[model samples]
Each structure stands twice: as C-alpha cells, then as structure tokens.
Target: MLTKKLNRFNTLRNQILTVFLFVMTVVLLFVGVTTFHVVSTLLKNNAEEQIEQTVTQANGRLEALYKQLDGLTNQITTNMYVQQMLLKEVNGDYLGFRERQNLQQLVNSFQTYSDGIQSFELYTSNYKRVFPLDEIDLVNRLGIHWVKQAEEAKGKMVWIGRDPKSPHFFVVLRQIRLMDRWFSPGGYLLVRINPEYFQFTDFITSKTKKQGYMLVADRDLTPIFSNFVGDSKEILHAQQRTVQQNGEEYIVVKQTSPLTGWVLMIVTPVSALTDGVAILKNTILFSGAIGFLIFFIFSLFLSTMVTQPILKLTKAMQRGKDGELRPSPPISSTVEINELNDTYNALVENINHLIQVVYEKELVRSRAELKALQAQINPHFLFNTLDALYWSLVEKEEEELAQVVLNMSELFRYTVSNSKQDEWVTLYEEIEHIRRYMEIMKLRWGDRLLWNIVIPASCFDIRIPKLLIQPLVENAVLHGIGNKTDLGIVWVTVEDCHESSDIVIKVADDGYGMDEQTKEKVNELLNNKEVSSAKGSGMALVNVNKRLQLYYGEERKLVIHSELGQGTVVLLKIPKSGEE
Candidate 1:
C-alpha cells in the first residue's frame, strides 16, 4: 500500500507538483503570520502613544495651577504690610483705624493674587486675622499637624488635600520666616484652594468619554479626583499597566506631577486605538489564501518547465547504455539545457575517436612484442656456441680457459633467462652472476684485475629486481677499469642494515676516475627518471639507477661519488619487501 502511494508521487510531474505546493504553502503561511503580527504591534504602539499624550497634557495643566498657588504664597510672605499686621496687637473688640487699615492692606494683597484662592488666614504666635471675614470671629490658630509638617518642610509650602471637616476645598500652608532675621519664627500663612478652580475633571472628561476615562491620585493612592466612575482602585496604583474589566481590555497610563506628587492616570480601552486592526487582519488572511492558490499554480508551471528537459535527457542516457552513443535533443526554451545536449554529443564523438586510437596503438604494441620475441633467439644461439667453445678448450687440456668460457655462458644464460621472466632474483644468485662477469674480465687483464666481494651471507638471500646490480658492475668495468692503463682494484660490498630495514650495496673501483664536471653529469643521468634518448657513456649506470629507483623508490636508490685520479664508489640502497 505504501509503495503504491509512493509510486504515485514518484513520477517527474507529481514530484515537481508536490515540491511546488509545499513551498507555496510555507510561503503563504509565513506571509499571513507576519502580516497579522505587524498589525497587532502597530495598533498596540499607537494606543500607547495616544494615552501618553493625554496624560502629558493633563499633568501640564495641573502643574501650572500648582505653580500659580505657590506664587500666591510667595507674594504674601514677602509683603512688609502683611508682616506688620501679624506683629501688631489686638487692643479692643474693634480694631483701631491704623490697625483696620493695616488689616485691609493684608486683605488687598490676598485679593490681588487670589484668583483660585477661597480665603487667606494669617496665624501668629501673638495674634490672628482672616480676610473677607464673617460676622462670627473664627480663631486662626495653625493646626498642630500643619505646624509639625511645615516645620519638617523647613518653611517650604505644603499642599494638603482637604481642610478638616470640609470636603469641598484643598489648602496650601507655610511657616513664614522673617527675612534677615536669624532663628525668627514670624507667623503661619494658610490659603484655602477652591476645588472648582482645578478644572481637571472637565479636561479629563472631554478627552476620555468616548474612549475611556482618567483619574488623579495622591501619593498614598487615594482618589483625589477623576472623571472615571468605574472601579478606579487598580488604575490609581497601576504604573502604565494593563487590566481587564467587564470583558474589556484597558491600558492605564500614569504621569506624576513634580509639583504636588500627584499621579494623573489615563485609562484607555485596547479597542479604541486599534479600531481597524480587525479589518486589516481579516484582509491579510483573505489575501494570503488567494496568494497561496496563485503561487501554487505558478510554481507548478515553473517546475514543469525546469524538469521536462532533464527528464528527456535522462531517458536518452538510459538508451545509450545499450552501446548506442546517442545525444539528447536540445531544449528550445532553456540555453543551459541546450548547452548540456551539445556537450553530451561532443563527449560521445570524442569517445569513439579514442577507441579507434587505442586500437591502432594496441596493434603497434603487438608488433613490437613480436619483434622482442624474435630478438631473444640471437642470445640463445650465442649461449650454445659458447658451450661448444668451453668443451673444445677442455678437450685440448686448457682447463682454466674452459672454466672462463663456462662462466661466460652462465652469465649469458642468467641475462637471457631474466629478460623473459623479468622477476625478482635472490641476492646470492645475482652475486654469483657478477662473479662470472668478473672472471671473464680477469681472464683478459689477468693479475692486473684485482677484485673482492665482501657481501654478508645474511644479505645474499634477500630478493631484488633482476639485473639491478649487474648493470652497475658492467658500468664499473667499462668506465672505471677499462679507462685505466695501470692495475685497478674492483671491490663489491653488501651490508644488511636491520635498524633501517634496508640492504646497502657498494661497488668501488680504483681507476682513472672522472673530473667534477663528468661526475656531475653522470650523477644527473643516474638520478634522471626519464628514459635516455642517447645511449652514450655511463648509460649502463643511468639505466641501473633508474631501475633501482623504480623498484625500491627514490629514497632507496643509487648514490655515486667520483673524483679525478681518486676512485669511484657507486652505492645501491635497497629497502626490504614492501618497505619501499
């Protein structure tokens, strides 16, 4: 069941359709989510900004009112006539003319700056007075709480919410200090503030009736004033907080008055500022749905255009597996697909040309192998002739000469046998072959040719590539001993280096050695891995060195040293099996 379901989508068309639908779905989902989030954030930010502006305007007005009242207190305290009235004595029931005039002067001062002031009273340690007096005299003694608060304030103005037993008025009280008089307690000044003068409720009501409401609270969180009639307890204590009431969300913004330490809080509904967010959110969701459908169709079409050529090329490649080198047809709509078709055709043509070239080269190689096979017959015939010569010497009673001929024939056999096999031979067998060559040389130059083989017995059993050492021995004979007129000593040594897992072989010759230039040239040729074009002098050494390097690697190969009239030493370093 799962296989059948998977096979439905396995076709090129279905796979492309699935991919396009998945991508379009993800893109539509992302766009819808991002749009909704942006609308929500912008609405919230805009509401907060509006509420903040309302609180700022309200706080500014309240601050201005408090500043005017504060200035009124300053005016009374600085007036000399008011101070004089406080210092005067009360003589009779009715004040004397100067006393009454001085009292009126104090009342005139209150009238001058008392726009919002309900009444002003001066409380003295020695006397008392009230402006706009009633028929019944009222004692104007400072309240103990006001006196203590004023002292604590150090003569600064103190604002009180309401007068004792009076709910309709607030008061500002201060202890007047005599100017230029040290430690002087002059009198107390009290100004009754009519609550109507504030106009805070009307201002707050005008701004918040449709949206929300506003509240003013004292430092203790008491509801001093507000246009909001709902439960304002939370709003009073809230610090720019959010609250839900009656299933409605509200943002409470608070601003504190620096002058009175009163907080002005504006409570605005979340829906008021974000009125169009619902419309915007619904619009985004609807558009996203439409966009998803459109993108799905467009992506499906695009994928078909992209994959059709690829499917055609794949079919062509499958057909080519039957040994037919066919090229895919070019896609007309796509330049890249056309280029791929061109490249595929070019590759097939090149491969056919390569096949023809390899066939011709193979024919030439077969011919060369045949020629090499025929060349081996000449060496075998030489060997047979040498065997006959050895027996003829033996019959003539020349035993030493017969032995020399026998050794020469043995050397020829070793060379010709190894040429066919081309396999590794024991070091012992290689040294014995070297001995046969030395014997022939001794017969020619008799006691003048002194030679020694000082190879260790343990090293002789190690196998090395055939003909590796024989060519070096030949080089010593031809270049070293053959060039010298006097007696020459040829020495061969093999040392087994167990520590380095190697066998070190040396062939030394005491003959007319080469100069610096010749030594350098011979060394360069020996190290040269490239096949020699000219088989000139020292070609035997170069070929041997190249073989040793090929078999054992360059690190374990020939090292040659030579100097004029000194001697030549050629060392062959052979690593153990697999050590190379």
Candidate 2:
C-alpha cells in the first residue's frame, strides 16, 4: 500500500509538468508569429508612406524650377531695354538698313542678358530673315508656319518649329506690334532656348542614385535634352513605362508662360526622391528581426520563471480583486523583482496623499486671495464723486454735461468690476472706453481739442489687456493736448493685420510732440531702475508697457514714435486672441 501511494504521487507530478511544457510551446509560437506579421506590415506601410512624401518633395522642387524659368523669361520680354531695342532704327534705312541694325542689336542684347541661348534672330513679315543670317533658311522656313498661325490668332505670341542652332533648342516668337495694321509684318522677336537650362541635375542624380534620368520634351513627344546617354528607343520605352505604370509615384510640373507661348516641364522619379525611405524601411526590418530573435530567446527563459510566481501572486491578486488587501507571495529569485513590488505599493500611497494635499491647498488659497484683493479699495468714494458731479451739472443746468458724467461713471464701473484680477477686454470695449473719455475731454476743451477715431470692424473682436488703450489716450490728452496752445488733432486708428496675426492700435496727437531731449527723458523714465513711483513722467505709458510685457512676453510691447512740433504716435501691437 505504501509503494502504491508513492507511485501515484509521482505519476500526478509528471502529468502536470508535461501539460505546462506543451502550453508554453503553443504560447511561444503564437507570440512569434503575431509579432512578425505586425512588424512586417508596419514596415511596408511606412515604406509606402515615405515614398509618397518623397514624391511630394520632388513635385515642390520641380514647381520651383518652373516658376524661376517662367519669371526669368517674363522679365526679359518685358524689360524696358528690350522694348526700346525693338523700336530702334534697324540700320540707317527707315525700314531697311537701320531696321536690320536695330534688329541685330536686339538679338545681341537678348543673348547677352539670357544664358543657355543657342541662337537668337529676327524675321520680317515677308519671311525674310533680318538678323543672325547663320540660321536664315531655318528661320524663314519656321517663320512661314508661325506667320500663318499668327494671322488666325491675333496679338498672341506663338512658338515656331524646333530651334536650328541648338540640337535641343526650342524657339519662341512674338509678333511685334507696329503703328498701323495688326497683320502688317511687324517682324518676329525670335529666341532659341536650350533645354539643358531647365534640367535640374543635382536633384535628379542625388535622389535617383544615377539610376533614373530627367529629360525635357516638347509637345511633339521628342526629347529636347536628356541627362542619360542611351539608345533613343530604350530611353523612350523606359520613359513610357515609368509614365504608365508608376506615374503616380513620380512628380511632373508644367508651367506655360503667358508672355511667350512656351511650356516648361519638370519630371522627377519617385524612387529617387524617397531613397531615404527605402533605407529607413531596411533599417526597421533588420532591427525588428534582431529584436524578435533576442525576445524569442529571452521569452523562453522568462516563461518558465514567470508562471510559478505569477500563479502564486495571481491568487493573491484575485483575493484583492474580490476586495481583500492580501500580500503577494514573496518572489525569492531576484532582488529587483522584490523591490518592484514594494516600490509600486509605496508610490500608490504617496500619490493618493499628495492629491488630497494639493486639493486642500488650492481651495484655501483661492478664498484668501479673493478676500485680500477685495479689501483694498472701496466703492463708496467713486459713487460719491459721480453724485457730486451730477449735482454740480444740474445746478449749472447743463444736460449734456450731466449725461457725460453718467457715461463716465458707467465706464469706471466696468473698469473696476473685475479689480481682483487682470482681465482681457475686447477691442470694441476698449474703444468705447476711449470714446467716453474723449467725450469728457470735448466737453472741457470744446473746439480746442479735435479728435478723429478710425477703427476697422475686423479688429473689434480682438482681445487686448484690459485698460490698455485708455491709459495711452489719457497720457495724450493730459501731457500732450492740455499743455499745447495750438488747436490739436488726436487720431486713433486700429488696423487688422491677418498675415502677421496681430491687431495694431495707434493713437496720435498733433500737439506739443516731445523734442529729442524730452523724448530721451521719457525713455529714461520708462526704463528707469526706480520702482513705479519715481517714474512719474509718462507713468501711464510705462505701466502699460510693463503690463503688456508681463502678459504677452517681451515681443509684444508699447512702441512710441514722436517728432517735436509735428506729432506723437503710440502703436500697440497685440496678437489677436478671440478670448474676451
């Protein structure tokens, strides 16, 4: 009986070990297969994405080149010098010798001003070449075709046959307008453009690794210029294949010059553009392979050790999940494993305590600061002053003055309503405040102070630091207009600048503008080391500058421009934030 019992125990242990090994093997296979598929799929998608980005960059470069060439052509044709040369006497003959000489000079000027020109010439209305007789036969022949086309299409420039001087030359012809008739032979301004001028070799070779070639072609599908040397048939076939199969992966930019009926085409291969993407794809694949190998081996060792502690700890975790805080079984293998468990528990406790402490402190501080700010000033003083002004105006029997006092009181109320905090006000609200202040000034100074306010509707919604504009207006009125004997004009304008994403508020006063010495004194006061008290001169401007810096950083600050006896303009450049 004792032997049978021992044998039964051994048999049970062997069966459990066999089951564990089988489960581990299955898990390893699943993990390895899944990781491989996911990583491989990710690498392929990333490669395609990189290829698309390369195509976009290539398109941009091509577009830039096309634009540069188009601009150069347009500048040449429209140049005052070229136009004058076209109008000059050709030789000394009214319509013959002098005309030929002028035409020759114009050809020389075109060649000198522009590079990559294989030839330049001029043709008369009768198919007679007037200049550059070297290509006279070719010009006369091409001129017949263009002259016929020019008759049907009036006033428009036409491109004639392939250039004769350069193997890859393209010609542009414009009918020069004379005083009399539209079709009267005005002579053609012919230019021969080398296709090599537009070939961007650096971009193509660097991107395509010399495997791909770039070529410029005319509307006839004939290659004007090519960077790669090969049989024409092979080159054409490769180009056709690339265009048909992987055209989407390539970049093609076409620009037509309105001045000259010439088309600029730029073509770049996708593979050349995104060579980095291919490299990146390979790097990721290699790294993923190495990582998988390392992980697979490490997983084998880790799996066996993982199960025993996991089972023991999982049982304890299950108890906690059921609402019992039980300690996990101590892992005895490594010191790091034991420390991880301890640290996790300690971190959770510390976090919970810290959250509670922060919540309590915030609530306490909010209440205390609000109380302290509110206790600084009283509302009764402002109310009593307004009431006295109202009574005085009533006694004087001035209804407008009493109304102005009421408006001023309302303005003051809005300003002091949020005294406890610095707030942002809409440009419209600031403008309204300034208008109220201006009204009060108008009542005091009458016709002596003339004010003009120009504000755009778009700038009305932009937010500014509260009370920003009012201080500047106050400074202008008190120190500027009040001290001047001459009648003054105060201009306030608000400009909305969408490009720079800013709103500019400008206030100018044409009264007693500061001299250089006075300006220097004011600047000194603004940047003075003394606290807010010693900087009495232009204190309002200084305060505004400080507040602007504090809220909007150093970039946004008050700018002052003043000329003695001329005017002073204060510009405030504020970023447009829609927040009220």
Model 2 TM-score is 0.37
Q: Lowest-scoring 10 consecutive residues by lDDT in candidate 1?
A: 133-142
Q: For model 1, how does the per-residue alpha-carbon lDDT over 133-217 read when each residue is reduced to its tens digit? A: 4332223343567667876776688876777647677777777776645526566677777766675666665764437677877
All candidates: TM-score: 0.44, 0.37
Which numbered prediction scores highest in lDDT against the true structure?
Answer: 1
Error of 2 at 208 (Å): 8.0
Worst 10 residues of 2 by lDDT: 85-94
Candidate 2 lDDT, 349-405, residue by residue in tens: 565544544554344345334644574266678777997998899899988989798
Candidate lDDT (C-alpha), each: 0.73, 0.62
Q: List the candidate 1 regions with Cα displacement exceeding 4 Å.
A: 1-274, 278-375, 378-380, 418-421, 527-529
Error of model 2, residue 535, in angstroms: 99
